[model samples]
Target: MPISSPRPPPLLMNLSLRSADRVSYCADMASKLAMDKRLDDFVMILESNGSDLSVLVGLLDARMVSAGICGLICEGRVGEVVRVFRLVEGLGIGAFELCDELVKAVLGLELRRLVEEGELGEVEVEVEVRRVRERLKRQVVRSVEHGGVEPTAGFIRR
Candidate 1:
């Protein structure tokens, strides 16, 4: 018989220690969607995802896949979302940050939609959204500089 090595304790065990304060990311995202009516367009885009995700990804930009996930998470349908993060890990998309980017993209898309709909005055919306995006960029840069979180990767760049 071959000798087998003993395994270390599971990381999930460590995660369990924080279980009480562990908010479901999906639930938190859903709350944001509730507050942002503009996210409706992104929701519709996500609701359109069908059985073949790969095919859909090919037809649309790869970012749409992330958008779709945000849509599901925002809708509180966590069960329906694919666990792509697990597959992409080590290829370098930190799970936490992927969710962050997806949510950010959803918000961006919503803001754009609102401007197009004239719900927001075009010039005012453009300036405000640009400012908010710049602020978010600076915050992300600070997070990277502080090593607070790893920058995400593994996305198919368009």
Candidate 2:
């Protein structure tokens, strides 16, 4: 279970991240801390609201929604993950949102044990280091407007 740094720490500035980038950066940092098994470090940063924010932007609101949630997943806090996920899902901040990343993180953190114990087959865990680009073909257009995201099962519980 090894993952390398994909998006490196941002260069220093007064406020390096804005909008959803802030949360995305923090979540990436949380993933790194989780990979390194550094719970204390991440908790301290969260407690202080990005106090030791990966040596980038040390202090800011930073949203940190993703970091807090990712930390819970890494720490095996399943109940809290669902609780928090439902809350953040309604926020509607366009960029760096959790819809896709949540799926990947959950798969990464939860499936490792099954794979290691020989219950599940090998999966693509080395996603951070693999960066392949492909050229695109000619464009095609189709318009089938649909509802936004289908509400998760969590919404039904309401």
Who wins the lDDT comparison?
A: 1
Clashes of each: 0, 0
> Stretches of candidate 1 above 4 Å error?
1-120, 153-158
Per-residue accuracy of model 2 over 4-118 as CA lDDT, tens digit each:
7677554453156673565556655654553343544544434443334333333322345445555566665544444333333333323234334764566466767656776
lDDT of all the models against the reference? 0.46, 0.43
- Give the lDDT of residue 44 in candidate 1: 39
- Residue pairs in steric clash, candidate 1? none
Candidate 1 residue 81 C-alpha distance from true site, Å = 43
